[model samples]
Target: MPLSDKHPTVKRRRSQLLNHFLAFFVFAVIVVPVNFFTTPDHVWFFWPLVGWMGPLALHTAYAMGLFDRRD
Candidate 1:
Protein backbone atom coordinates (compact mmCIF):
# COMPACT_ATOMS: atom_id res chain seq x y z
CA MET A 1 0.00 0.00 0.00
CA PRO A 2 1.06 3.60 -0.46
CA LEU A 3 2.70 4.95 2.65
CA SER A 4 -0.03 7.52 3.17
CA ASP A 5 -2.66 4.79 2.83
CA LYS A 6 -1.45 2.92 5.91
CA HIS A 7 -3.30 3.05 9.22
CA PRO A 8 -2.05 5.66 11.68
CA THR A 9 -0.02 3.22 13.82
CA VAL A 10 1.28 1.42 10.77
CA LYS A 11 2.28 4.72 9.23
CA ARG A 12 4.18 5.68 12.37
CA ARG A 13 5.96 2.33 12.43
CA ARG A 14 6.73 2.59 8.75
CA SER A 15 8.17 6.04 9.37
CA GLN A 16 10.41 4.60 12.04
CA LEU A 17 11.48 1.76 9.75
CA LEU A 18 12.29 4.23 7.01
CA ASN A 19 14.35 6.19 9.51
CA HIS A 20 16.32 3.08 10.41
CA PHE A 21 16.84 2.20 6.77
CA LEU A 22 18.20 5.69 6.19
CA ALA A 23 20.50 5.37 9.17
CA PHE A 24 21.78 2.05 7.86
CA PHE A 25 22.04 3.37 4.33
CA VAL A 26 24.26 6.24 5.47
CA PHE A 27 26.50 3.83 7.35
CA ALA A 28 26.68 1.47 4.40
CA VAL A 29 27.75 4.24 2.04
CA ILE A 30 30.91 4.75 4.03
CA VAL A 31 31.43 1.11 4.98
CA VAL A 32 30.91 -0.55 1.58
CA PRO A 33 34.03 -1.05 -0.50
CA VAL A 34 32.31 -0.24 -3.79
CA ASN A 35 34.29 2.96 -4.14
CA PHE A 36 37.56 1.06 -3.90
CA PHE A 37 36.53 -1.66 -6.38
CA THR A 38 34.81 0.44 -9.01
CA THR A 39 36.78 1.92 -11.91
CA PRO A 40 34.78 5.18 -11.92
CA ASP A 41 33.90 6.44 -8.49
CA HIS A 42 30.15 6.79 -7.97
CA VAL A 43 28.32 8.86 -5.36
CA TRP A 44 24.92 7.34 -6.05
CA PHE A 45 25.50 4.85 -3.26
CA PHE A 46 24.55 7.61 -0.81
CA TRP A 47 21.15 8.29 -2.37
CA PRO A 48 19.17 6.17 0.05
CA LEU A 49 21.05 7.69 2.95
CA VAL A 50 20.54 11.20 1.61
CA GLY A 51 16.89 10.54 0.88
CA TRP A 52 16.41 9.23 4.38
CA MET A 53 17.87 12.30 6.05
CA GLY A 54 14.73 14.30 5.22
CA PRO A 55 12.37 11.99 7.15
CA LEU A 56 14.90 11.45 9.90
CA ALA A 57 15.33 15.18 10.30
CA LEU A 58 11.60 15.76 10.39
CA HIS A 59 11.10 12.99 12.92
CA THR A 60 13.82 14.46 15.05
CA ALA A 61 12.20 17.84 14.81
CA TYR A 62 8.83 16.42 15.78
CA ALA A 63 10.30 14.55 18.71
CA MET A 64 12.07 17.67 19.86
CA GLY A 65 8.87 19.75 19.85
CA LEU A 66 9.96 21.75 16.90
CA PHE A 67 6.87 20.83 14.95
CA ASP A 68 4.36 21.94 17.64
CA ARG A 69 1.23 20.37 16.18
CA ARG A 70 -0.84 21.34 19.22
CA ASP A 71 -3.03 18.29 19.03
Candidate 2:
Protein backbone atom coordinates (compact mmCIF):
# COMPACT_ATOMS: atom_id res chain seq x y z
CA MET A 1 0.00 0.00 0.00
CA PRO A 2 1.39 3.33 -0.98
CA LEU A 3 1.41 5.65 1.96
CA SER A 4 -0.23 8.99 1.34
CA ASP A 5 2.32 11.72 0.81
CA LYS A 6 0.51 13.94 3.26
CA HIS A 7 0.93 11.43 6.05
CA PRO A 8 3.15 12.78 8.79
CA THR A 9 5.53 9.86 8.77
CA VAL A 10 5.97 9.95 5.04
CA LYS A 11 6.48 13.69 5.08
CA ARG A 12 9.13 13.42 7.75
CA ARG A 13 10.88 10.58 5.97
CA ARG A 14 11.05 12.55 2.72
CA SER A 15 12.21 15.66 4.52
CA GLN A 16 15.06 13.76 6.13
CA LEU A 17 15.97 12.20 2.81
CA LEU A 18 16.11 15.64 1.25
CA ASN A 19 18.48 16.79 3.94
CA HIS A 20 20.70 13.79 3.36
CA PHE A 21 20.79 14.45 -0.36
CA LEU A 22 21.76 18.06 0.22
CA ALA A 23 24.57 17.01 2.52
CA PHE A 24 25.81 14.45 0.01
CA PHE A 25 25.83 17.03 -2.75
CA VAL A 26 27.81 19.41 -0.61
CA PHE A 27 30.21 16.62 0.25
CA ALA A 28 30.76 15.80 -3.40
CA VAL A 29 31.33 19.44 -4.27
CA ILE A 30 34.06 19.62 -1.66
CA VAL A 31 35.60 16.22 -2.28
CA VAL A 32 35.78 16.16 -6.07
CA PRO A 33 38.01 19.20 -6.51
CA VAL A 34 40.12 18.29 -3.51
CA ASN A 35 40.58 14.77 -4.75
CA PHE A 36 41.35 15.94 -8.26
CA PHE A 37 43.93 18.50 -7.19
CA THR A 38 45.50 16.36 -4.50
CA THR A 39 45.76 13.23 -6.64
CA PRO A 40 45.49 14.20 -10.26
CA ASP A 41 46.33 10.78 -11.67
CA HIS A 42 44.63 8.67 -8.98
CA VAL A 43 41.09 10.08 -9.13
CA TRP A 44 38.97 8.33 -6.49
CA PHE A 45 35.94 10.54 -5.86
CA PHE A 46 33.53 8.28 -7.71
CA TRP A 47 33.99 5.53 -5.15
CA PRO A 48 32.39 7.46 -2.32
CA LEU A 49 29.69 8.84 -4.58
CA VAL A 50 28.71 5.36 -5.70
CA GLY A 51 28.86 3.96 -2.20
CA TRP A 52 26.59 6.61 -0.75
CA MET A 53 24.26 6.92 -3.73
CA GLY A 54 23.29 3.26 -3.75
CA PRO A 55 21.89 3.41 -0.25
CA LEU A 56 20.35 6.82 -0.86
CA ALA A 57 18.59 5.44 -3.89
CA LEU A 58 17.24 2.66 -1.76
CA HIS A 59 16.15 5.14 0.85
CA THR A 60 14.41 7.22 -1.80
CA ALA A 61 12.58 4.20 -3.11
CA TYR A 62 11.55 3.25 0.38
CA ALA A 63 10.31 6.74 1.08
CA MET A 64 8.32 6.56 -2.13
CA GLY A 65 6.75 3.34 -0.86
CA LEU A 66 8.16 1.16 -3.63
CA PHE A 67 8.79 -1.68 -1.19
CA ASP A 68 5.55 -1.37 0.74
CA ARG A 69 3.20 -4.31 0.90
CA ARG A 70 -0.07 -4.08 -0.99
CA ASP A 71 -3.10 -4.23 1.20
What are the models' TM-scores?
Answer: 0.42, 0.85
Ten-residue region with minimum lDDT total, candidate 2: 1-10
Using lDDT, give the best candidate's number. Answer: 2
- Per-residue lDDT tens digits for candidate 1, residues 1-71, read 22244468556765876777677766776745675467346645566566767877777665444555554
- Each model's lDDT comes to 0.62, 0.90
lDDT of 2 by residue, 1-71 (tens): 55677999899989988998998999999999999899989989999999999989998988887887786
What's the count of clashing pairs in each model shown? 0, 1
Winning model by TM-score: 2
Q: Per-residue error at 21 for model 2, in Å? A: 0.7
The regions of model 1 sitting more than 4 angstroms off are 1-41
Q: Give the clashing residue pairs of candidate 1, or none.
A: none
Task: Please give the lDDT score at residue 56 for candidate 2.
Answer: 92
